[model samples]
Target: MNASSDGSTTLFVLLGRIADRTLDDATRREAVLVEATLRDSIRAKALDVPDIAQAARAARERGVTVHLLDDGGLGPYETAVADEIRGAIVGHLRCATSGSITVRILPAGRPTLAAVVVQSGDHTERYEFPAPTGEQAHTLFHGLRRGVGRSHS
Candidate 1:
């Protein structure tokens, strides 16, 4: 992101450095918040300004979603926590033939988020959970497969 560009399609690299005056602390990391600005409009990027008040005002005016997750800065957390998430999913995937699984970190929080899309022939099942460590994934995939453990007389 160029720090000196004002043209269209210019990228802006901003830090979450809006200070907290109420706490009266002068720490750098503590002052930063877990937030980012999304500029859908041409003039929606005033958060990069030198003044904190103006930056906050622009954020308040332009912000629509309750949660804004920019997890680019969370690489360490993602790497360290992905294996546990994988462990939670491996057992349930025994029956899945064609499917897709997505594992994601919670960004500024603990407990990873995972979504799995299982395909058993034409039927598909999708689920979102905090890294399923149980039969949740198994049930979704197993049920989609017909006549698995049936008693035939």
Candidate 2:
């Protein structure tokens, strides 16, 4: 999507306009998708996406957040982890119930897909990684599961 230093600022501006008191619900959804695409581009870095586990650790101290645009492109492992992530942030935000959690699947030259869930307010909390196999993947899954979770044990 980075064809020219990348992404149109207009899309970002439109996200702000989602609050226009006159816009119908349908229009607002479109505006959010546009906004998410650009916001993901800006946040993903495209070249060097951060490791999701480490980022999740940091996010655990803050909060987890995403609006899923997965579209079934993510592999099984990513899909499972993404499911966990989707579960983690449910009902956690007061932003628009629909577009509050913005998850952008970014393609990097790395081995695994990156999923960054963002809820922009006073700050943005996001994390993603190329989910590898074995113990590492298990750890990644757990981190995402707990990114916004409070353990009862």
Candidate 3:
């Protein structure tokens, strides 16, 4: 999460709950197959892309402050953890999004799969973007990692 100069905070939150479940040989293989199928569906547009816009609409109706950040040119792997580790994150402008994803791997002749669940919320989402130099980016990376370590505890 990052706070804007205007004193509102925009947080990007990821919530995941991992579970332990026992599956027999056949069942475990099936799970992997299913994940690959779903991934293909989304990629082919057989499944609709994610609908973040709907959440924005609901926030507007309820009179809750909402800010959307669309930082382009950054790949998913990088952007996924970028803002969360930035120095500018602060305040009640806490915006949060939660989700779960499952990935399974099976033996030969079987399949591998993954599933994800997502939820997003905001008290008052304050989006922020400050051009950080290379040194600043390095600092942000370490800071974010430190924050993540604390949360796990």
Candidate 4:
């Protein structure tokens, strides 16, 4: 992370929650509350990581460009937001799985703030898909599709 002459800290949190899966509900709710507190703390400067997805959305709405980094799958937490954030303030959204560890690099900006929302419940689990074989229906689709196939017993 790099600091500017101005007094603003670059904050980045790694969010790793998989899509369409239930996470620690308690933790998620706590995140909302923590996010509010964080906003208050960083009112004088820059802060990051109060709520995972919501914080980014808020930042974007406030003319702060939001850059999201996700593989669309579960992955490890790595500090990569520094390259994208150029504004006076920087923030991050990070999530972790059972065996993964999150890491962040502290830059020269003073009063760097970070908050974590941890829930006590079942973590997200990965799913697998079976490859299609033989002749299957083929068509040109222009929109989203949701399909659930049943397995033979």
Per-residue accuracy of model 2 over 1-153 as CA lDDT, tens digit each: 352232356455565665556567766665654554444445543211223322322333243333334433344554566566444433232222332345444443445454445545555455555545677655665654444533221
The lDDT per prediction is 0.31, 0.44, 0.27, 0.27
RMSD of each candidate relative to the true structure: 17.6, 11.6, 18.7, 18.0
For all candidates, the clash counts are 0, 7, 3, 9
Q: On lDDT, who's better, 2 or 3? A: 2
Q: For residue 42, what is the lDDT in candidate 3?
A: 37
Judging by lDDT against the true structure, name the best candidate: 2
- The true-versus-predicted C-alpha distance at residue 72 of model 2, in Å, is 4.7
Tens-digit per-residue lDDT, 34-143, candidate 1:
22222212122211222322223233333312121223223343333343333333322333433332212244343435443444455555443343335543342333
Please report how far candidate 3 places residue 68 from its true position, in Å.
2.1
* Model 2 poorest 10 in a row by lDDT: 45-54
Best by TM-score: 2
> Can you rank all candidates by lDDT, best first?
2, 1, 3, 4
**Model 4 residue 150 lDDT?**
21
Per-model TM-score on C-alpha atoms: 0.26, 0.36, 0.23, 0.19
Q: Which scores better on TM-score, 2 or 3?
A: 2
Per-residue lDDT of model 3, residues 1-153, tens digit only: 011221111111101111244456744544443333333233322111122223322333344333332222222224433333222222111232332111111122221111111234422222223333446544544543221222110
Candidate 1, RMSD to the unseen true structure: 17.6
lDDT at 79, model 1: 36
